[model samples]
Target: MARIELLQVADAVAREKGIERELVLEAMEQAITHAGKRKYGQEHDIRTDIDRETGEIKLMRYLEVAEEIENEATQIPISEAQERNPAAQVGDYLADPLPPIDFGRIAAQTAKQVIVQKVREAERARQYEEYKDRVQEIANGLVKRTEYGGLTVDLGRAEAVIRREDLLPRESFRNGDRVRAYIYDVRREPRGPQIFMSRTHPNFMSKLFAQEVPEIYDSIIEIDAVARDPGSRAKIAVHSNDSSIDPVGACVGMRGSRVQAVVGELQGEKIDIIQWSPDPAAFIVNALAPAEVTKVVLDEESKRIEVVVPDEQLSLAIGRRGQNVRLASNLTGWDIDILTEAEESERRQEEFHSRSEMFMEALDVDDVIAHLLVTEGFSTVDEVAYAPIDELAAIEGFEEELASELATRAAAHVEATNRALNERRLELGVSDEVAAIEGLDPAILVALGENEIKTLDDLGDLAGDELIEILGDLAPSIEEANAVIMMARAHWFGDEEPVDGAEADEAAEAAAEEHERANV
Candidate 1:
């Protein structure tokens, strides 16, 4: 290629592809190097360089002068190199300039192919670097085409794709339509950079709100959380650091203009902006707005909340198809179960009766005594067994002697239950190794043995969800199940610290084996 022609081509390709001109020049040089290798011998070390300022092409064959010629193709003896140039020394590379070749049809096509491949690689790299950091930011683009229920969007300099599932429900984009979406992901693939866009992501709505509401962008009001039902309804939880600012009001703007802007972008999706509170109960109350919550019962251990609403507001709290409560649960990061006042009352009564019955059966106490125990917040035999004798004696009509007797009976009952469970576990032939896993209590062991998880290997092979399903309500949460499984598999990792009763079992086995060997 001519010097000026090469420079003009490089500049044109750089401008068109939106890449650095140096990259195009490097690609051209690589193409020249490939063509040179084909014209000369493929075994020779051919290198090519293009001048940045003048675009002058230089092709040369390089040979290294070594004490011993390792490869005749690319290495020469130091003495032979000194004959070519007296100043040449060992470990020096000698370059022989070659005239630029005139391209035939095949050579020109080959050079163009190499240039195209390298330029494409550079373009993909450029696109990846440009958009990788832009994930989660809102992007504006024109719909370029629709393929397989997905839309390809042209974002001026780059192209992105919004899969059908990522688009709003019942929404479609035509070619040339202006669209706004969140850059959910940018991935480097063999073909090119994959820019994944989403219109229905909760963050897209949050971003739109941030753009419309200056308080949110300026950090005066913070968007704590967002949950969406795509085109139907959504909820946003916001909090204000400034005591004077009303976070919900600021997001809603004058006459609901700000939220309306976000809703417009979401294709008429309804938005509820609620003020966030540090107190979970208060936050839940705010989340279930327009529906009056009569009471809330929170189980922090289980991360669940039972929300009781008035009978009239039950339907409103649940919304159409339980959308309201679902979004509220997502917003608060808690499992929410909505109940009516009557339902809550019935549940409470049933729980009271059940606790009374449990105490009556376990402690052999009368109905009145059981009711008293239940009223004093003693629900389990373990609680009664572990309670201080003085605390039980303080109960109305309870003497210290009677409290002590009850405590003794409670302890005996719990021991009996555990003994029965252990007997059953042994009868089922659960290996001591399985039972010795750190988190596997007697009940869990019985459950595991019943399900044929009778060894440590079996327990280790179980996934968290599998373990939870096997143990039913007695199983720990998924996180705890995973930890238990890891403990079970610890012996496989070579560190092999004995867990629980594993060391005792091993010693007993060794002693029994020694006895058998002596008898033999």
Candidate 2:
């Protein structure tokens, strides 16, 4: 209320809010200046200065010298300046201090409102400094409340928002529940600091592992890479500094107690701990664990791997709904394709039989059936899989219902063809062997999706572990695989021509010449 008391109020508020006293004084000056401008029309430049030392207030009015003083608010005449300072030149600009006008009632109210607004602005700036750098750091929050699919969390110092997409899939927090989140982003807005958080970040998993594993926390074990499908599964690749220290074992903990602790925080999502390997092939195999990979062909250019697992383990390698493979892809930074043993055979068979496979044995028209199916028509085995019953009925001399029956019977045969085609694709290098296999049927091949297999060259590149994954479902005979390789070796690399009499004599002469040179 009084001049002396303004200093005491400024000092006390500054100390309480941790703002500089000069800043408070500057704010007081600006606020009073604003209120004065509103009350006394600020058409001219107005300055209000507060002496922090004495708590005295002074207001000055400034006007530009103009030939004609059009508005009284902004211009002072040459005669007015000479009256105040007798030596003043006609062109000299002058400022006049307005005498202290008491803020009897209304001005006091305006000053109080101004002071309140300035204090709020200073407080906001102070809070922003306290929270801005916390971006990307982890923080714990209690679920304060929820509205419109978003969460408000109290992080002790400030509140943070956790968006629905930022949440772990299938995991929900109730009001008052404590949750940890990765600080994904933070922004200083006009209202306040907006701290964004996420429980779905892959780094959150890495941080959790570091917290749970003493070795990792201590730097004795380092997590090399991590892949995650938040709220479902994750794969982490870890390494140890000492050969004796088992990095994977340490991360897993005794009976998986350590990982379980982390998992509990994450609402039961599964984590697979794997030993990081320098060899990409070995790492890929390890990544697709629980499904034995038979071979892995690396495409370093694409950062992709064509992996082959046994004919039975396909589903397991790819995982339930492809989550396992998906996480592995993220962790490894690799594009992975899984192929089975039968698929390899079916691929090669289609390639080799592209022409000859259409011609039938002993029947000319039935042969036409194969020709039309492959040459002029359906490219996919699925097309033949669901080919119209009437088409088969139209085959020369084919009858009613007999045609449908033929379609029904051909259904099985079509599946066999597709399966055989798939089997051919997988034949190390020979699709022909898949075609020649006596029991092969195109319809059966189609059903088994065998025709989709393209080439053995394609199969040869796959990681064996990928094919081994197929064992979970289509368990093809391993012995048959070995036999196919043997046949392939015999057919392609084996004797292409009989040894002639002249060649035998030339071989004997060469051996004699070699023996004479050795003896010499």
Candidate 3:
């Protein structure tokens, strides 16, 4: 290429890819020089340069000026070289320029490839500098085009990619549309810099709230935690440092206009702005919004809650298809189960009858008189009965002997609860369907309501295709879900049942009933 044309190419490419012209020139010189060595031969000591004015490349042999020349490849006699062209004097070196670059055929082919690769590398480094520190920051872009699987977003100075996974579900961008995304990552690679953008990350919601809510930006209102279902719904837990300002109301904006703008930006993604609470129970209840929890029954060992609601409100609390409950459990990190009016009543009556029967059994045994054992807060009968004395003694107000008696009575209760629970399980039948959940999180169960993935055993049967079909884009994440399921299943079956809340209730009631019957 001519020198002027070379310079023009450099200018155009540098501008197009946001690279420096000097860097491009340096890259070109090094690349051409390397090609010169391989084409002619690395055996020759060669130097190459692109004339600044001509944009033409020049190659030459660089030999040292010496008293006597013995090696033709590297040394030249100063005196002998002077006779050829008196431009050189003794002790001075002369440039022995080579033939104009033919770059003919193979040589030309090689040079082109080198320049392309070098420029791509330079562009990648420049992009990395622009985006590496931008994590959690928002940027606006013009939708240049939508490729097969993602959108090309053009920032004023650079471009980024929003892939299918990064997109909020059911949301899309059209060519030339204006869009905003949270920069998720900027990676420098051999090919180029990859600027990753996301619209579905939880932090996106947090940052968006900060943008729309002044209190959040100014630190008057603080976002404690956020859990999201992306395009479908999101739950953000916020708190106000200044007691006078209502955090939830501030986020909702006056007449819901502020949050509405953010919602519209996300293509109508729903949001639930909630006040945060330090109390887990309160937080759990608040998290399950749109569904009023009449009462929250917590089992300490289980770290679970049984949420009781009006029978009519079950579907609402669980959300249209249970999204509400799912978000709540994720937000609180607690397993929750929803109970209705009839279910709660049956549980209570069963509890009373079970205790009465256990006490009646104790009365029949003479040695066990007026037993003063404490109900170690167990909810089910069998857990205490089959449980070890040490496990029972671990409960508050329990002694070794008391644990022994309680464990024995608990054995009976557990045996009974097991028989009944299993009979119900049998009636449900073991058909082709599998409900493979390891243990039940009442809250998560309530949230999952109808969307439940039955069991791990069942999950293993699902082929990747089937799993993908069930979750759509979420199908790829089935592995992670399976991991949690396996862990929970192991915990449910392990010796470490840890006496859940329901178990504790049974243990405590057994103690009270046994004491009453002995005295009578």
Candidate 4:
């Protein structure tokens, strides 16, 4: 009866804790071992084992057979060990059966505590193993409690937390309310496995759409990107594999039924399903809908775009407090600057006038000639100096002789500017070593000298953005800037000088394109 009851108790604990039967037996063994150690002697090598089929418990003291007894408690001389067993050998453990122990009140309590602690540790391990692989999955649970920091949710077999910040703005829950969230992360902590859930995660919205729209689940439509403002609004870019199916329309569903279901789940947050495009400009234009874009000026190297909208549509384009443009920027992974048509036109005129003035001063030409040069897309003296004679003569109303004269004047102006800048650079103690650096012209060298960066090491110490800031208008793209900095630091690494500016620029541009493709 005692043996049957022991097995029955172990089975009950295993079933209640949802742990393996072997784990319970192991916990029981450890508990018995602790009790035996307390009753016998703490210094003795006490061990306990239970019969798997019979539920029989055994207690023993193991003594290591040695040439000489080092400690009376755990080691025995081989001669004496052999007397007990004729085959006793050195390094072998000889077991002595210990008599069954009488369970005192204190011993029983101590054993129970040990078994409970071990069982709890096993349960925590099981929980962590089960949930760790479930990250990024949507989970449904009951709101067990609400507190100042967050809500504790009772998942069927485990508990999870939805931090205050992870909850959508103005959303609330009471006890026993059903809640669904994205399990963003699972971490094993000392107390237990911590499953962190979020209601406002961008993926949460994406997953909701995936559930509500069968086309998304079947891979007929793909979600390219998502940006959310939680309770206010969101933008999701979708692409369709089949040309016959419209990605945006499929996501919007028949009469907006699918999207409305998602909106209801998200507490009535507005959603925009935009068709994604291979062209970034087109995608960005699609992202900022309901506000027509008059023009788009993209700077690929900087991953920035200037968007021009009608003056009346400015408020709608930017949204209330800039939310629309901000969400669009987040979705497209680009910095966006919104401008009204009037502002863009004014800026363009200012640039044209500035370039014309520069040409008039540099080439010693009249405003009419300067205007013609600017209109012909000649912004710098270097461009005119190095341009092919055919290109210059091809401009309207320009002859070959006039083109040659203009090229000659442009070259002379560039030469004179370089000479003056070099003189100023020398006066500021700029080193010739800096001039030898590829991608750096005389003007940049002079700028560096003025800023107290006069040595190779000084230049090498600058980050790409810092160098770009110092170069101002002459700054190269980020990749090119980094290449230049690496060239300056070549000596530190015992490496040869890097490729010249044009080759380095080409390499950097190629690398940037490859990286962009990988990301896409």
TM-score of each model, in listed order: 0.84, 0.59, 0.62, 0.94
Q: lDDT per prediction?
A: 0.88, 0.70, 0.71, 0.90
Candidate 4 C-alpha error for residue 249, in Å = 1.6
Candidate 2 ranges beyond 4 A from true positions: 3-24, 63-117, 170-176, 214-221, 240-245, 254-257, 348-520
lDDT (10s digit) by residue, model 3, range 1-520: 6678889988888899899998888778877787778867786678888877778788887766777777777777877776776677555656678886666678777877888888877877877887888877999999999997689999977789999988977776789999888997887766667788999888888888899998899999999988888788889999999999999999998899989988987778889988799998899888988778888889754478899999998998888777888889888888889998778989876765565555446433332321322233443344456667787677665678866876666566556655665554444442222334533322223222234444443443333345445654323343444443334334333464423333433433343354456558
Candidate 1 deviant stretches above 4 angstroms: 66-77, 361-365, 397-520
Candidate 3 lDDT at 483 equals 40
Which one is best on TM-score? 4
lDDT of 2: 0.70
Per-candidate RMSD vs. true structure? 6.0, 21.3, 14.6, 5.4
- lDDT per residue, candidate 2, 10-106, as tens digits? 9988888777787788788887787667666778677798887788888877776656678778777767766776766645667778766567578
Q: Which candidate tops lDDT?
A: 4
Candidate 4 C-alpha RMSD relative to the actual structure: 5.4
Task: Supply the TM-score for candidate 1.
Answer: 0.84
Ranking by lDDT: 4, 1, 3, 2
Runs of candidate 3 with Cα error greater than 4 angstroms are 1-13, 49-58, 62-112, 299-302, 362-520
lDDT of 1 by residue, 1-520 (tens): 5799999999999999988999998899888899999999899999999888887888999999999877999999988899999999888999999998888899999989998998888888999999999999999999999999999999987899999999998898799999999999999988899999998899998899889999989999999999999999999999999999999889888998888888888889999999899999899988988788988999886789999998999999999999999899999999999999899889889999999999998888899999999899887899999999999999999999999999999999989998999999999999988777777878888888889988776776666678889998898866677667766666554564624243433433343354456558
Q: What is candidate 3's CA lDDT for residue 431? A: 22
Error of 2 at 103 (Å): 5.0
